[model samples]
Target: METININLTNGYSIKSLCADDFNIVKELCEKCSDYYLLIEGVLPSKKDVDEIFIDLPPNKSYEDKYVLGIFKYDELAGIVDIVRDFPDAGEWMLGLMLIKIDERGNGLGRNVHRALSEWASNLGAKSFRIGVVIDNHKAMKFWSNLGYKKIKEVDMEFTAKKHTVNVMRLQLDE
Candidate 1:
């Protein structure tokens, strides 16, 4: 696939992530979702993060995966992974999203979310699914405000731990 770059209103850009960017992307995920690590009872490690991405869920299949790095002034600012045509017809999985620790609550997420939604819709997708950690209030609200409604409460096992996952979807068929 060709490298696609999306420029945000806030001067950040999202481009295809390469293998060499894993470390910084891992650091971004760790810092943004520190709560996950706390609950997993393990500190951050390259292996842990690699495992999560390397062997992502079935919906996030190898060929359909689009791992994008959010960049700002030549630095990694966030990451987004998308799996096209997953779990259902005309739908895609918004697998992972993480912004830098210092960049939260500034409308950056909304811009990124909007860009991705538009991108998917243009690609013929009808909806997008996101699995939100049920108890993460910030993330829950963020997804909700983006018009994603919780459709189910699913149990998920990740990194050897079980937790409730709120399966949410944003309809793009309008």
Candidate 2:
């Protein structure tokens, strides 16, 4: 699939994520999850990072997987992915949506969400789902602003700590 660039007011753009972005994605994930209850406490070793990276499917390879990067003047600022999975419903899940700390507060999250939603719609997704850690109020608020409503909760274990995460969903065709 071709990556469509989203022009920003500051002259940067949002582009589709590629395999070449693995290193940046790894770094961004590590740093962004510093305060995440699940990752911060569970992933206490470098091996954890490696394991997580290894588990990710190749970028844009799966028929229902799409990853995107937020860029500022050619610098990677953040990333987001949509994976269509079916456990009960044909759902598209948002994964690893992150913005570099310094590059945040410029409405990048909204832009990324818009881009991902468009991509999901093109994929014929019926609903969009995302899991947010209970402690991550900022993310909860952001997802809420994008019209996601809390639908379920799960007790997730990472490292040795337990976290209650809210699974939020948005009906796409509504």
Candidate 3:
């Protein structure tokens, strides 16, 4: 998959993440750890983050899963992961999405969202589903502005934090 790189106001280039970007990915994940803890109610240890890098699934490798990264210059800025629903489920899951705090407001999120949606559409996905924490008003508003509506809510338990989070889904098809 080809991704066009764009230079942000900070002179960082948003591009596709490659296999050799483990260090950058690790840094981004580390810097954004607190944000994830507050928003997702789970704090991932450095080992957990390292394991995530070790287990990154290849992009466009299967009909059901996709993983994409956003890079800033030579560093990793954000990531988005999608997985198709189980048979008869009729939806695709927007599994994971994260953007570094420094790169938050300069339209990188929208760009990543558009790129992922386009990829999903190309892969025959009719809709995209995501879960957001109810307390994350900023994220809730962001997703809503991107045409995602809350379809349902469920309680999820995070073992690392032992906190119950509210999960919300957004349907991509309009």
Candidate 4:
């Protein structure tokens, strides 16, 4: 697997997270468990992060999936998972993105998103796709503000709950 290091506008950086960074990844997930619980009705565990680093997603034979650690001045601030050429050609999937509890509502989310967008564009992605729980009002608003539009709603089984997932899409600037 190739390690990617991306520097943000501020001192924040998105770096490749590996098995060795389990603790930091676990902590970041714990900080996001509440949000996941609110929508998926289940708390995220360290094992979830373990699975991503240990096993690759289905239909992906190579290492195109990236579980990145978002760091701000050496402290892990969040985590994100991005996949290239998923569900469609030339499409990038923002599979998972979560900001630390205390770090939300401070414009950090936007920074992380912008940095991800730029990184994907640099890698030749023509569009971005993300799935959001239908009832997640805040997330829907947040993504919409970032220029992603609700394209379709599909049923998704997440953590024991069957959710109506709003598939949002954003056509990147070419």
> Top TM-score: which candidate number?
4
Better of 3 and 4 by lDDT: 4
RMSD (Cα, Å) of model 1: 2.0
Regions of model 2 farther than 4 Å from truth: 1-9, 36-38, 42-61, 88-90
Candidate 3, run of 10 with poorest lDDT:
52-61
lDDT of 4 by residue, 1-174 (tens): 788898886788889987789988888877888876876677877667776565545687447788898899899999888888787767888888888888889898898888878888888888999999878888888999999998999997877678898999998874
| lDDT of all predictions | 0.79, 0.70, 0.63, 0.83
Q: State candidate 1's TM-score.
A: 0.89
TM-score ranking, best first: 4, 1, 2, 3
Off by over 4 Å in 4: 54-57
lDDT of 1 at 61: 55
TM-score of each: 0.89, 0.78, 0.72, 0.91
Scored by lDDT, the top model is 4
Which runs of model 1 end up more than 4 angstroms from their true locations?
A: none
Please rank every candidate by lDDT, starting with the best: 4, 1, 2, 3
Deviation in angstroms for 155 in model 3? Answer: 0.8
